[model samples]
Target: MILALAIPAILIKEPWGPLVLALGMLLVASFLVWTLLRRQSRGFPQPYEASGLLEVVLATSREWLWTIGPDGRFTFSGPISRELIGYDPSELLGQHYSRVMECEDLAEAIRNRAKREKPDSSWSGLVTACRHRDGRRILVEVSGRPILDGQGQVRGFEGTTRALDVPSAHDVASEETRAGVEAMLISRTLLTAFQPIRALNNGNVIGAEALTRFLSADDRGISPEAWFVGAASVGLGVELEMLALEAALSAAASLPEDLYVAVNLSPKACLDDRVPALLQGSSIPLERIVLELTEHHEVTDYGPLGKALAQLRREGLRIAIDDAGAGFSSMRHIVELRPDLIKLDRKVITGINADAGLRALGAAMVAFAADIGASLVAEGIETEAELDAVRQLSMNAGQGYLLGRPTVAREEWKLWSVPVHLKRPASGPTTGQHKRP
Candidate 1:
């Protein structure tokens, strides 16, 4: 009525405003019709005006909005659920949130919920699998926060889930990789190869590094590193690493008791609670085990890792920083971790016999290791000249093609039970003749 009264007054003041007046009236009429339809559809009481608006917004959104009670049962599921997962909101109410989650994603969702239990805690962009009403799985990106009561305790959770449209090629490859890794884990088919780490001075085997090998027909052409990278891409990196660790530790049981078995592990895997349990349960004694930190991945924060390593060390297990001098991160790891051993990377050991800079770096590492009371091991000693160079530097131990190749044969492993003298090259120049760059 107010608009009706003001329209004539404006038209009388400006006679040429009929088109403007008609357009304003049409807009007002359309808005009234929309408001009326919304009110009738929602049937909300006038007192719930704001809630009515929220309902309209949620009904139109593509993302599914959800709320669950403290007990994890669905309290409310938006109308979008019907379009998103083929389940009507009414069908989802009172069901557990797990009802819509894929089996593999349930544990991850539970972990995220635990985080939300803390005050003001929220999580976003957690991509997980959701189950559809017809047994199909949908990939979704989820974001949520805990709902708090007046007393600041978590009352429930509210969240939004949007379906992800991954490119078909990438999605197919990821699914294949995930399935492959899962099969490998289930069948326990990973093979352990032991590469001897020898004493450079006496040419006697002191320890063997456990290397994981995938021997399944499907995995024949894929390198171990590629397999691990594929597993990581599909959110199964930790699972695969743990499986490899278990396999390596299990194989270590057959090796000589006097020899320490060095097992490679990523920092993230070390932080897993299962690691300590795995180590404790191993038949091999703690003192006979060495945990080598693979340098391919960077350690974001060393405090927790340091604490974890400290706990393991106190249990009599030694730690080695693998691939030291490969990069600045590796150097940082040595300074921060203060490992019992520092293994020189293949990059640093290759051609050290002739490169003055490489020799100087090797000499500096030898000095550094002695100063820190850590044993130095040269890796990838493929040629006799490389072996001569590392031996000349007085490296405590070395492992390479010249020493011994990684072998899965039990007979070859038994050969290390006795002292074996490794022949040194007679032609290489001695360390005394090498000039400092």
Candidate 2:
């Protein structure tokens, strides 16, 4: 419209018409150029805003954005990965995802997501473990989405990693606890002590439960339970359990071949593929190693866990349910797992000799074990009466302070030829002590 009007004004040559036409033509041309530029600019990335928001995000964000091929090889690793894992960006390329992501539970979660996710879907909110380039382990929250090709095949994976935030008093406490546990693990400051599990019939030492004690920097001892809880909080439960198991196996190497060694593991740790790998490398015979499945946490899904345990059992490993009768759920655990041994909890065995109800409960456990073809091991037999009580109940095994405290001396274990207190009458004074040579 402006051009049609401008042409008439230019042709008439009216004084102001030429000037008006000139300005009109100029305005029309400028408008056309502006429109074309806008269309062209749409094909390119948007110009960065003056606020520099993208630059601010790239500079300040903590998440490590990453990409990996369908083959699980890293294709790109963000700067945060290099900073947190102590690896150069180039070092991560071509490395298998599992090389950096080693935790069993996290791997299982990833595998499950891959199996269940729809094409082009994303999974997130998973807190997982990743190995630092320095050989340390750190907990991170990971979120990932699958990248798909035109034909709908998964071509690659994209993800972000963020450091797990310690956001509450409980989390802060957990972080402190994890730091303490990590320090102990790094320093190898934990001491493995063996508490003898004796046959109640003759008090003959048939096996021993391996216990771990963290010797703090101040030379004070921290209980195994506390250390283990801390480890679980930090996603280091399996690793620390492996360490304790390794220590137990090392100590077992020097003991008499006839005496089996019982090592405790959480159900989750028991299912970890790393457990079997660790076992394979150890010289300890499968039959001589009893993996006592302690209720570190409740067993939620027993099918998969039972299958894993069954595999180990097929390899000649024995499974024992520790701390039975501490709660009713423990009995359910025994029934579901069908372990070879049921350890009566200290609470159940502590005063059974005096408390008739306790004695009856102990007897019931013995019968339950018998019905299931399992042996009952009574723990926390702290008195002669407790010993006599469990003996009457036909307990298959017993372990307690009264029998023997956790001993560290290898000579003492080697010289354990017979039951140290077996000769004493069950009615004898509780002081019938077993002296370690």
Candidate 3:
């Protein structure tokens, strides 16, 4: 579900063999997953032995495998199950897959899934339960490939599952979790909150970034990761994303003409035609709405991404690369795509004041953006010192705690509208307090 935005690394210009294509997809997807798991551990075990029963079904057969049951139980498992659960395939059986899961989470998810709702999950990866060998329940990553029975009617589900190895839902009963989860389950119930992105020098509210808040009955807040993961689990990720997009566009319609609204695009939804079409109808100028490529996803195909962006650019829509330094392709990608805005990630800003190498890198990035005729926006500008350093970097703009905090239902969005250098106009040009959102 977290990977709902993940795009396959390879693109298909023209198809030759369906079987070959499927195999290719499997290998690429499996490798990506394996990397995520193994890179964190010394050496993870494979799902099942090549000669094991699960091996025959998962390896020889194309049907995806899962060691889970409908009640979110991993009472049984297959070889591939080990790949997902981080346990021996034989260890899991009769374990309440939801045992390790937060109770409230299981209930809510089950309720949603059983509703058989059509979610915006066009790009959501499937999830399943796989029993761990040690009789422990683990959440497994899986791909749902229907296991057809002799009758050809739907009987049971079969998919690959991977354990995130995450501990119990962080405070599932907490009000925040409840609110976030409920909003995601019922997309429209959530309000798309907007916070202004101001220019440090002039205090002008140049843009607004939409943030989500749930109007849940319980009033608990949900994390973006949890919301996305739950939505992906029930196959609603794309729909949720689109719903957010709609809300964002609607919210932006009330802002100034020059104020661009930046909306996040899930990896899977990147190439979706609906995105361009929706923007085309927006009341604001298309060029003013920045479609940020979130670091949460990887752009598997630079060619397609480039081509897609080129078409958008042709339509006068500008682009911005979010979390600039967080990916293997961040800086390289900025050059490749040549976006209008390059957002410097917070990682580089964390200790730049104390680290010369980091400061130089940050300075270089600002210079690179200038050289490419793109504006550089530094994120995480929390400290007065950071603001001074960033200002010295001479980047086009910056945003962080040092400037202001993100406010959604502010009494007056204009309160923090001052441009950089004028943020604390009454305070003798001293900077304002900056805090992380």
RMSD of each: 21.5, 23.2, 24.4
Q: Could you give me the TM-score of model 3 versus the true structure?
A: 0.55
- lDDT by residue (38-92, candidate 2, tens digit) is 9877865456463477567656789888898875668888778777777777877
Local distance difference test values of all predictions, in order: 0.77, 0.70, 0.57
Worst 10 residues of 1 by lDDT: 428-437
Better-scoring candidate (lDDT), 2 or 3? 2
Top lDDT hit: 1
Q: Which ranges of candidate 2 are over 4 A from the true structure?
A: 1-172, 218-221, 419-437
Q: Of the candidates numbered 1 and 3, which has the greater lDDT value?
A: 1
Tell me the deviation in Å of residue 67 in model 1. 60
TM-score of each: 0.59, 0.57, 0.55
lDDT (tens digit, per residue) of candidate 1 on 1-437: 57764875588567667776777777778888999988876885665788888988897899999998875667899988998888899977765564565222433343444444543367666556665664444667688888999999988889998986633436786798789989998998878989999998779999999988766655423446556656776888889999999999998888988899999888888889999999989999899999998745457889999998787799899999987776667778899889999999765776677678889999999999999999999986766777888887788899876778788998889889799886764555733211101
Winning candidate number (TM-score) = 1
Please report how far candidate 1 places residue 284 from its true position, in Å.
Answer: 0.6
**Model 3 local distance difference test score:** 0.57
